[model samples]
Target: MGRSKDVLIYIDRRNCDFFQNISDKFQVIFGLNNFWLAKFFIKTKYILFVLVNIISFYNNNENGLVNAVVAIFFATVYLVKFCQKCEIMEKMYEKGYNLFNENLILCRLNRGLFFVLLVLFCGMGSALICLNGLTFFVCTHMLLAFCIVLIICAEYFYACTPRPKGKSKVKLLFQKIQKKIEKIISPEPVPDSC
Candidate 1:
């Protein structure tokens, strides 16, 4: 029993580390705030799957334009929500706020979006597989399946992981950028006439 407990603890620590590392990388790459980065990593697979489904459906369907528009709308909503989340995270970070109590609310929003994306992808995949059968669509379907599994694994790792504290490399880089922007926007002090 003790050994098992130790193993679980070790696993949790490793998961947390993994989360932190990925979150940092994502922040650097996407300029997402830490809080949003956490959510993004958790939802990465679903987002990608939804995108692929949208593109595939748009390409293969008769009502291609309509499908493409709707898919684009959903993608746009996701991006907008992500931007809003990043703004909220930035405010919270500046306030030194901890989200421990609000984790459920944040998670529910994240999970709900993920669920919607999953259902959409599944429906699209099923339609393609059924209508098209074991044809060229099968290759795309297989790729989608692989991506879903990969996303599931990623979600697991993120769930097991804890949010990282302290400034990440990305945060530091952004700080520098912000400082430069501030310098540009703020007027330089006039040299003393005397």
Candidate 2:
């Protein structure tokens, strides 16, 4: 709710040289609580996903490669979740800069303990890899793929909430349990993350 003085701002790292020139060094007011860590974590997820896709595809790594095979689907799913219902707002600060075209998209989200869950899952993956005689640094792709699988599963559960007409029993279950799970994760009502 406050225009934070110190905050973590993130954008996906683009490999192309052109994006470096156009990247805005502006801090938009963050609409949530102290979310530097959360924002950084979300950025990390995208980095991991992209790295995994590159490494798996480039190295021809197909051993236990279901995650790689369906990566495009997962990427699409993640994009839909993040970019759904975004509204581009006309600029109020573009009076001087003619060379730089800039606009903001208002995208709302129910973060709903997503950052917390992601850390836990990623940690679990790290633990699994460590136990199997592998270093986390050595197997970033597998670890992230594992974490992303859990993220997609969580997304599925969220999607099943009884928001639509003619709700199924599963949706009803989600509706009833959603509040309880949120409460368990946080005492105060959690706000949007994205």
Q: Using TM-score, give the best candidate's number.
A: 1
RMSD of each: 8.7, 21.5
> How far off is residue 22 in model 1, in Å?
4.9
- Candidate 1, residues 63-102, lDDT tens digits: the string is 7667667865765675567556656655665677665435
Candidate 1, pairs of clashing residues: none
What tens-digit string does per-residue lDDT give for candidate 2 at 1-194? 23331221122112111222222111112211112222333445666676766676766656536666587567657655443311111121223332212211111022224444556666766677777765544476355655554443333222221111234455567778998888888877578895
Cα deviation in Å at residue 58, candidate 2?
5.8
Candidate with top lDDT is 1
Worst 10 residues of 1 by lDDT: 153-162
* Model 2 misplaced regions, further than 4 Å: 1-47, 56-60, 63-66, 88-110, 129-132, 136-194
